[model samples]
Target: MDSHGSSNGLREEEIDAVAMAVIAVVVNTMADKESSSCNMLMRLRQRRALLQSVAEAPDCAATCEAVVQLCVALTSGVFPRLTPRWWIKRRTGGTWEDLRLRDDATDEYFRQKLRMSTTMFNHIVAACAAYMEKKVTHYRMPLPVEQLIAFALYRWVSGETYESGTSAFGIGRATGLQAFRDVISALLQAYPDAIKWPMGRRRAQILRAFREKGFPNCFGAIDCTHIYIDKPAGAPSENYYDRKQKFFVQAQVVVDLDLRILDVHVGYPGSVHGVRVLHNSQLFRRAESGELFDATPENLPHYVVTRGYLLGDNGYPVACPWIVSPYGGIDQGADEERFDTRQKVARGCVERAFGRLKCMWRLFLRTHKTNLETLPQQFVVVCTLHNILLDTGMDFDENLL
Candidate 1:
């Protein structure tokens, strides 16, 4: 048990010394092949200098290893031919750079896949940067934004946390907490076209989905979801003011039978009731406007083929004549009960959409700390693409589907 050497057995500290010794011997032996004992000692010093040039930046050692290791694991599934160059793909997708990602799995097709796999990842980060540049900086920060937003749907929809999402990025825990929110905002604003509410198209898409599902005139399933924010400064009982029993903002969304989000209504105080949320929603106002339905679109019954109303929760006012539901004050078996059950069943589409939405983005899991000032923007960012991801072509078969 020598302090720096293996005697009885190598202790933890001795193990490092042994590893270094082995490395030293390997280098020396290679040099010794061309000459006798110490002829190439000078060359050995050059090798150490090369190693220093590749040293990890201060405090970034583990993070770099983690990123490289994660890349290795992901690419390995798609790339089996395992050479360093073959295992690496450009995060930018344009030109190949020397990432030095070596692998041992010697399959030719798999190795080709390794190079191919990085192309999509490069696009992911590029998309994030393009969005962020417009939304946050308006094309100011020239640095490449990580693929945080693109992979988000994969995480929440597929079930993962912020920590897991940024495992590929060099971002840390607290940074991730803020970064996720920041990225969503930039994404929504920058790529509104990518996640826009189809002013007229919603009508057609909803009609089609309703017909397929055997429900008519159904535009969408609507619901109120609350996102918690920290209680404001000097607000009395703010902490106790939420439906979920927390200080928060309540927002509503209208998603169609296909779980495609058609409209979003966010940015209300938690003190706002669900009915109030709908009443204030642009979707409800538009529905009540009757300009289109009366003219071109022709007021498709609120919930078309079901020959009733679009679906919603109990907190919504029983505009029972226009919208079908159990009379809030009436018994469960009242004339509206059967209708209410059917509406609830239809409403499940949006609920499941919300679940899948939340499942796809871990940022929704926690109550983000924000004031009323920014509440609407955050909720909008979360909802706008809540429906578009259905088309993002993300695979869920790896899960039970």
Candidate 2:
């Protein structure tokens, strides 16, 4: 009799008898079907790599095994036969229910197996664990934290609803909502300086990085993305509209060459025009004070800003300091066209940065679940994490954007 049996309410003698009987049954069964049992065990071992975990400790490791079992139960019906796109369940395409795990069968099997692997969990664990501590409090248990956070970011990027996050991320309704907020909060707090400076030595390095090309000192790519927010239930907010007229929170962001957000203005009450927001922003003031300085090439241009430019889209007012879109019919020459192409290419950095930030960390993108009043602080947090990812050189999925 073992203490474990007693914990299960079985008396010691009774447990001992049942254990011996079970052992005898296993021995007899294994002897009668040795090859079959061995093959079954081998199959189980092969699939063990696909599980998720909280930590590497034995208990946490076991929880990962449990996840594998759950996945198997849910996915086994379609594993070998189903196509990857098909297995997604809610998809309406013909690919539905025929999901192929990979290009080849064995590779697909191994791919599925990795879901249970300690190595795989290690990566998810990296994002879920202490990596975010610089911005969040410490709390580790309940492995669902990994999936919840992963799905929250995915939902934001996909522009799906919060309910989609819950179902896709395997989080309960309440947990799904709370986790979206918690992960975003932790990220913003951990990397308070996620939005880095395009200044000093850093600015010099960026200039040098692009100096070989014809482009001169470029501070950052400036752009405004219309973040659609839930409108105030009560307000006289007709001004938020453009000539086309739409309700959205106009957020202006400036990201350095590395795609790290340098500055953001998000509290414009969902009605302010992009031009108005920038006019009052600190970025405009700093540029006006003749503050942007050159680090080398001792020409010492009268306005250091005269040498540098903020790459902007068609919506912005462009100048020597602000490289706005090409002037109407300004086909000065092929070289000018080449420069225009480069500027447009460079302008994408900000839009792509916003796309990635919203995709990876959902605190932005203005979901209906978010409180209207909390938008400002949430905007700050999302921008901050966007920079942290840049600093870390974390591999973000470009194809997603």
Candidate 3:
């Protein structure tokens, strides 16, 4: 009986050694094939079959049970089951992508889709790419800068709903909206000086252009327009209600003869008059301090001498010589009538500038449904884009007017 028991003890020792060796081999195999869960499971199953065959022999049941339990613990819960990382198969062959591949696509096509020439669009992409770039992550790659710009331009020009716009770009609505805001911020940062007031040679050119239009020493035309918005939540909504029975904020713009926006002041409530809006602008303060233009008086016909001035409508106060307004009141002499007529012609530049602005960027044509606080930044961004396009000599289609 002692010899039989000793033989069983020797058998148990051999089985314990076998279990340890198998565990080491399985661990090494799992480490080598860590990336593939399927392979690890297959190896585990093969090893379990081999162990069970060994357990079929005499006096190895208890040791085999212990080995199986250890293997089960290692395979079941010792290591986390790594789910294969994946992304939803989004539609990549969308409008912007297709436009990029089509050889026949023209500047006109780009203008129709993006409200700018292809060259201008590419220029904007180049300028804003640095600000729009994002870091890559383990889950997914960042979107291309061109895609973000195209999505923003499409949304701005088309004035479509976020759902429709996102569908066109094969992105979710929230993603598209966030992309639009990011692009706007990128533009604001990339082109900070795009809408600056002209100086030196540029100012001289603007004066010459206005002089040809029969207004001497004129810098630009200034006016105010309403940018409609939804009812405000914090501010007094009544202050935003305009004469047109719409809630809006006002934008005061100074435009050159070519309808390029030179300076802009936005965010005043629509109920405020143009004169009051002007009073609150930096332009007004600069003009008041005689720092905005050359203060030397230039002589005109009929002994009318004045410095560089902006032509405005009757809505502005004529208290300052720099801000020239049309002669008001019905009973006017022929000379005053002629002066008013010429002033109207030259000041029409501002009106046409507003028209082109709304036509090109139709986002302003509708009541703004997004955050009210962001409207001012968006306004400045659009104005900057407008100046950039003009600087590139890319004019909007006249037929669109």
Instruction: Give the per-residue Cα lDDT of candidate 3 at 110.
Output: 83
| TM, every model | 0.54, 0.54, 0.76
Q: Write the per-residue lDDT of candidate 1 for residues 1-401, one digit (tens) a residue.
A: 55443323435454445446544544543431343246346545644543342232122343345335434533442112222333323233211122223345322222232211243435445656645553422212222354344334333333345555445443345655666566666767555764444446656666666656545655666777766555665555553286557777666777777677766777666787778677776666666765223212233435533332466666666653344444454556654676666667777887877666664444465554444555576556656555444565543322321
Q: Which residue pairs in candidate 3 have backbone atoms (N, alpha carbon, C) closer than 3 angstroms, thus clashing?
A: none
Q: Which scores higher on lDDT, 2 or 3?
A: 3
State residue 278's C-alpha deviation in candidate 2, in Å.
Answer: 1.0
Model 3 C-alpha lDDT per residue in residues 1-401, reported as the tens digit of each score: 35876567436567667766766755654452243578557656766765665544455565566567656755564333232334333555377766576456666678888878777888899999899889743334466788888988887788777777788887777778789889989999899889888887888888889889887788999999888878888889999997678999989999998888988999999888878888899998988887888835778887988778998888777676778898878999999999899989889999999998998889898886756777888888888888888878775688877
Q: lDDT score of model 2?
A: 0.55
Q: Point out where model 3 deviates above 4 Å.
A: 1-93, 301-304
Off by more than 4 A, model 2:
1-151, 167-178, 199-201, 230-239, 269-271, 290-307, 318-326, 329-342, 354-370, 376-385, 391-398
TM-score: model 1 vs. ground truth: 0.54
What's the residue-level lDDT of 45 in candidate 1?
A: 60
What ordering of candidates by lDDT runs from best to worst?
3, 2, 1
Best by lDDT: 3
